[model samples]
Target chain A: MQSQSDNEYGIQVYNASINPAPRCPCVLLLDTSHSMSGEPIAELNEGVKTYFEEIRQDDFSRFSVETAVIAFGASDQGVSLVMPFTSCARVEEVQPPRFKAGGLTPMGQALERGLDLLKKRKREYRAKGIAYYQPWMVLMTDGAPTDQWREAAQNVQNEARNRKLVFLGVGVGPYVDMPTLTEICPDNRPPKRLQGLRFCQFFEWLSQSMAAVSRSSVGEQSVRLPNIDGWACVEA
Target chain B: MGKVIYSFGRFFGQAIGHVKAHCPAPGKDRPWCDQATADQMRGARSKTRSEPQLVFDRNGIERRLGPLMAKGGEGKVYPLADHQDVLVKIYHVRARNGDRLQTKLEAMRQMRPMLNSPLFGWPRLLVFDEAGTWRGYAMRRLAGVQMQTLCQPQLIAERLPHWSRREILKCARSFVSLVGKAHRNQVIIGDINPGNLLVDPQTCEVRGIDCDSYQIAGTTGLHTCPVGVPMLMAPELLGRDYSRVRRTFEQELFSVAIMLFRMFMLGLHPYSRTYGEDPVANLKSGHCAFGLGAGCRLPRGPWYKIWSHLPFRLKDLFIRTFRDGHGDPAARTLLEEWNDALDEYLERLNKGWFDPHLVPSAPKSSHYRGSDSGRRKGTASQGSRLFRKNA
Candidate 1:
């Protein structure tokens, strides 16, 4: 026994109820080249899972943290968008895809793809009038790029300098070139070297940092990041 | 019924057998009597290791825990076996230091007499583990949905469609009364948000939960409520280190004003606009869409139309709270003033100034289609102006 107006109002009310919340988008740019095979790949998988679990537990982050995982050197395409941007709640429901390291490192292609996806997502947010934090691109690798990477590094530097995105580069194991990571990351902050295969601790810090960002008012000058002494050492 | 009688003797250890004789039949006036008896029997028989349990002592009173009802960032809430009216909250093992929590709980117990009113679920019993580790405390278990469910206007509209404007007004009045009672007791509800209040839809009764977190005025050396929800926090507290700051009554009043605005406006936050994407930023910048001659006004839609139906006195208070008092915490509306204004609004509604159902007018044009373009155009012009002013 509902009238036309009542039905229309119901739809409007429903739309209002499901209004878009402010979003904190994070892109995980992972390297799955042959060097990451064994313990490194296993630990990285566990870390990603832990990251999702931690984000899901936070009430605000579950709705606000939109995550996308893109892996390089894991597929025939050189780089693969393993998971598109999804809320932490949805990420928790799906079993994270297992990474098998076999191909050559295509870090530049992966970085470019991650930046492209983040920019596209931001545009969608603007079109839909959704509020967002500066998107985060976390690049973790253990080896040098097999493909050309100067342009990708320059793109990251430009975005980071403009305060358009937060680019945190992490070099894993002794084989990683720390100097390259510094060049790729923003000038204000240098890249950090992961201690041992401590991917779990690293992701835990990332999750906590994202939670802090999502908690603050959007468009604030800077979010106070939690202490990162647990899993990282400044790359010398 | 016979099983309950037989088990009652074994459960209460014969002392309460005589009381069982006076127990009424099922579905009678004293239904809780049967429930209590059943609970005792269940307690005596069940010794399952899988079921989590905690034991705690308040003064000399010992309370046995039951199944967990809910869990949060701080602790787990379990119903008391013998007492149906009370529930025990056991804090997580890593919550602060044991001695500090003990001191805080003891202070809460001292404040019990003033907080015994029905509006509060104040801490009544201090709980501990087997090794005397200070865990958490017990308080009254409020039976109802969280006020958060009704914080938004759409939920209220959909859930309580039959409700008139009078009923909604009554709900707001109940909320104000609860806050007034706490203030009278000299307790600052540090984290005042919809999640912390429980509302019984049928009776319009509002009860404040998480009383353990309330800042007791003069409890020296006790751990205070250190944090607040960002959305509910006043502008001054937004970017500061909250753990170091002691929240005052004036700061709490700011949150109260925001809550009242939300309740009266259906779920629309005074700072919320279709164009403005960040609510926290809007609050900090004092961009109240409903304020008079404001640059960023509420989108011209159903919500704006509904605003016209509000009583002028209440509207004026909202403007004062969000606009004039936006920068200064002391300028916000006081609890007593809110109580007075809401009471007057209720009186006028009773006198039939307008029908509540008639106030929520359906949009003439589809808001989704028509308002979006207009809102974008408005945002392009007004948004820049507001940004410049704020800067």
Candidate 2:
């Protein structure tokens, strides 16, 4: 048996009270490729920081929402779990990894890794018998996938269709392949194109949606998400 | 950072902060000055700061505002410099030109009769900026714990650890009574969520805040509440374009039922279950697990453990409100009915008719495992049977 001090995904397993409330796991799969070096990368950093701040302010979401950050195309790691699943309250204590965008977008590898992390987290929740809302996978990219992505898209489709998770695809700029995003998030809810560099508004909407999900009883009813008119628009 | 700088200035600038001077007017001492000394000092220093001071004209009497106390989606609430009991909410630039916002504020200003109740933090005066720009209004600040803290099970368990089922029931009663009083005044609490209510745990007194958002009946030219919190909205309102639909008393009643359910049922939402992934889907489909129907069984855990302790009449009311009234707003339980049921239940508990100690524990086998044998044997079993038959 593992020791009491053992940690899973950077979280201390023995600290049961770290997340005594029901959990809402959210994985942010971001593309930090060469195309996202200057303003795009800076805005993305600010947006993620704002998201954490907003979640921490909410009393329920602070304890319930667990966020993990996965970045692609930054280094040889291909897909790096820069930040593991940590409660919103504790996320502020740790410094987030700064991204210096370079290399190609390895979207397939990131999706596969994100899925694996979510599955492992679910297993942990089950082992502890902790009730949880369906996990959320948010994919944001400014370019097309430069690697084999068909299998990863299929996996996302299966999970979304089974109602096991919610996948929201956000095309950050005009360069993103809208068709692939539609294929990856194929739960009748099409991917939305982020209007301008409204990363703050997008993250605000995500936090609000997470708060709604965390407030409700897990596994009972579908949370009605807030209107996305503020940050997103239909692709032309 | 600003507060630290202000504190340093106060301690050093006033000669070790021991400067005691006589009242400005001789022989007429300020009784409230002792408590307001810090505020006066801050007021003195703020004169040099560049932060904009909001100016409010309350019935021809102008009041200058201090710093912001809090901010929300619509506006920022600032304390009135002259009035200790009042706070002015100034609409942000985005909300300044909102449709019919002024007419709504005007309608609220005319509601003097309903303002008599302490349970409501009703708007007292219409306000504007120095340039005659339509800002927002002023209202009495409620001093108590947020209802979000009281209604959330985890917060209640952590902060108010001594609270029991009796106290929860008392809180529920107070909520229902407040709703009833608001309804009597022809005001519909359109945005009926935990954030809009505040509770005093010691006194069990419930006060409804954000009274300006309520839909006032028969108010001409008033804009209806165009938005609602999805979790608290009625099932019929779900998935609909909110801007096209005006909220009614029936919708408010549905929200009241949801609030009462969360309070008495340990924060379990009426439509929440372990099987579905989407609450709005469950609500739209009328798939409340706690109600009467096939497969309508309460989820296992703390909720199931203490459910039997609830009085039968209240259980029936829950069933009626959640099940029968799931789609039909007319079938929903009235606020008066909820008030009476909660009041009677508390009365019975106070009279020693119900034994608090006998409230059963969870069975050896968890209900999540689908072990029917572990189900309660008395009122719960009968209630489920009645629910099935009625369905």
Give Cα-based local distance difference scores for all models: 0.68, 0.68
> Evaluated on chain B only, what is the TM-score of candidate 2?
0.77
Docking class of 2: incorrect
The all-Cα superposition gives candidate 1 an RMSD in Å to the true structure of 9.8
lDDT of 1 by residue, B1-391 (tens): 1111112223244313333354333336443334333322322221223544657463333556766555545666677776545566777767645577667666766664444466777766566666666677766555445565455444444444555667667778888888777777777788887768876655667778877778775475535676577677787888877656777777887788888776665545566654565667788887766654665445433554455555556776777888777787778888778878878777866765433552355322223222234543443333233321211
Taking the tens digit of each residue's C-alpha lDDT, what string does model 2 give over B1-391? 1121112223223312222231122113432233222222321221122444866463334567866665555666776675544667877778766647777777776665555466787775667667766678766655445666654554654445456667777788888888888778777788887778777655677888878778776467535666577667788887676656777788888888888877765555666555453455666787776754546344434455445556668888887877788878898998878878888888877764443321234422222222223443455565545433111
Specify the highest-TM-score model's number: 2
RMSD of each: 9.8, 11.2
TM-score (C-alpha) between model 1 and the true structure: 0.65
- Assess each model's interface with DockQ, reporting 2 decimals per model: 0.14, 0.10
Model 1 complex DockQ against the native: 0.14
Q: Write the per-residue lDDT of candidate 1 for residues A30-110, one digit (tens) a residue.
A: 999888989999999999988888777654566678899999987577899999997754432655667888788998999
Instruction: Report the Cα lDDT for residue A99, model 2.
Output: 75
